[model samples]
Target chain A: SQQGEEDPQALSIQEGENATMNCSYKTSINNLQWYRQNSGRGLVHLILIRSNEREKHSGRLRVTLDTSKKSSSLLITASRAADTASYFCATERERGTSYGKLTFGQGTILTVHP
Target chain B: DVKVTQSSRYLVKRTGEKVFLECVQDMDHENMFWYRQDPGLGLRLIYFSYDVKMKEKGDIPEGYSVSREKKERFSLILESASTNQTSMYLCASSPHTGGKNIQYFGAGTRLSVL
Candidate 1:
């Protein structure tokens, strides 16, 4: 079973609008990372936020982690058509025997319109 | 920039055929992973390696196996490819540092079993 799940399986918005995707996980994690995948391509690492960190930012991407809620959100500010992709949240479990293995969510497909 | 390269962008094979999907990372990352992506199911990890000659099974490892004879190369093998194994296969690599496991991914191989 997948450890994480993302809400609003699909999201569409105008180019300048901000896109927000949420992810909820089942267990305690050492860290959570977000990745973006363009159509039919490999995923790209966007940002990573550790369990101890509440929020992080990189360029126009903002990520927030709430351990109490076992959830995380990725926000793309001032989105562009180039940002259209599937966004996935992956969790690195704190107690898993498999080191460096990540459990990924179902992912939210984001479509940015021009 | 980190570059994780896969052997093929697309592949088509028959059921009961042995198949190999190769991945190489130029960054010399310590950890490498293999995952399959499907519609509505997200990405499922198949196998991973932390070092040369070391391998670990991930969540969905039943139909797949991996080899890491060299530090920079990881190969996913399907002993007998089944129709159910048709999906997008991705390879990723990451460095072991700072409690961070941000993975860099390859463009993926879209495999079809006929």
Candidate 2:
């Protein structure tokens, strides 16, 4: 399992502040993804950055991938109270067979206070 | 809108009992996955199916089995439930478009074994 480790197991911030989380994995990957879970229910895919790509943005989310370091960072700018949730980083390795599987890191619990 | 739906929001089962969890997707995705999320442990894949009647074990597939009879439906079975099996189960689906694998997740099912 190419399980990754996430830095800062927990984070707290006020509304309108920016939040950033970082992830480090052990193996080479095809892509890395960030996901947000609200109340530990459904997970919504926030953004994805491929190995060849340096940075990618979706809405208020910015994801940067550094394959040379086997790490990635997710930045959420101008966060809202609704953005308070657990964030996870997942790695998609190059599959030899039929595989769209992802290995996730221990998530970072973020609290955005209003 | 693409959607993945799990059968139950919460479930309670006794130890040694057989348990089944069902998942369905509407996007006609080729890849479907079942994962268990534990506190501080992140999401661990139990099983995934890329096509009908084809299944692959994920990182932690112990005591868990899966079935993909149709394209849109996937089922997870625990032959014998245990106290340690109490956790949040998440189902996800991803389309096979070129080399891109963007996953869509379902509202998870919280299962508790007593």
Off by over 4 Å in 2: none
How far residue A58's Cα lies from its native spot in candidate 1, in Å, is: 1.4
Instruction: Please report the candidate that would top DockQ against the real structure.
Output: 1
| lDDT per residue as tens, model 2, B1-114 | 899999999999999999999999999999999999988788999999999999998889999999999999999999999999999999999988655588899999999999
**Model 1 C-alpha lDDT per residue in residues A1-114, reported as the tens digit of each score:** 899999989999999999999999999999999999999999988898999999999999999999999999999999999999999999998874546778999999999999
Q: Could you tally the backbone clashes for each prediction?
A: 0, 0
Could you tell me the TM-score of candidate 1?
Answer: 0.97
DockQ of each: 0.82, 0.75
* DockQ computed for model 2 against the true two-chain complex using alpha carbons: 0.75
Query: Against the true chain A, what TM-score does chain A of candidate 1 give?
Result: 0.97
Candidate 1 chain A, poorest ten consecutive residues by summed lDDT = A93-102
- Clash count in backbone of candidate 1: 0
